[model samples]
Target: MSVVTVRIPDTMDHALRAAAADAPSLNAYIVQAVRRQMTLDAARKLAAVDAQAALDLDGEGDAL
Candidate 1:
């Protein structure tokens, strides 16, 4: 629908081009890669917050 231009480092650009060569289109490959990374990053952040909350609750009784 909408088109956007992205600039990548020369090495990354070459790698992405090679990786997406078998993909139907460059856009599709980029979208898939971004979506996968976003999911993993969000999960990692949530896990860190959950771990911190558990640690805080270990010593505090009812405040948490």
Candidate 2:
């Protein structure tokens, strides 16, 4: 529920607005994208803090 200000290159801004056309708002699109990236990053890590099995970030074990 906080507002943030950021700066980006003009080309990137153009692309972002085009991509966000289907989203309810530019802010919502960015927020969703951030959440998805964080989820993928966490999924690639060593293990969950609750003692769950690792999800195979090291290019070895089979993922669940």
Candidate 3:
């Protein structure tokens, strides 16, 4: 694995460390957080696409 350095606000860093006290490592905690965010983003995008498809279908029904 490659090493990446990031600079964060001290308060945020402290909060993360405290929240992640039960985690095995800070890196693992950050990775889990990022993965969770990605999943949430994907779900949101899927919902938006489904909503648009519903709207399109409704318009089609009106034209029929």
Number of clashing residue pairs in every model?
0, 0, 0
RMSD (Cα, Å) for all candidates, in order, is 7.8, 7.7, 8.3
Candidate 2: where is the Cα deviation over 4 Å? 1-3, 46-64
Predict model 1's lDDT versus the native.
0.80
Query: On TM-score, who's better, 1 or 2?
Result: 2
Point to the candidate with the largest TM-score.
3
The pairs that clash in candidate 2 are none
Off by over 4 Å in 1: 1-3, 51-64
Sort every candidate by lDDT, greatest first: 1, 2, 3
Give each model a TM-score: 0.60, 0.63, 0.68
- Expressed as tens digits, the lDDT of each residue in 1-64 for candidate 2 is 7777767688799899999999999988989998899988877673454556533368666665
Give the CA lDDT, 0 to 100, for residue 4 in model 1: 76
> lDDT of all the models against the reference?
0.80, 0.79, 0.79
Model 1 residue 60 lDDT score: 57
lDDT against true structure, model 3: 0.79
RMSD of 3: 8.3
Q: Clash pairs of candidate 3?
A: none
Q: Model 1: how far is 2 from its true place, Å? A: 6.3
Which TM-score value belongs to model 2?
0.63
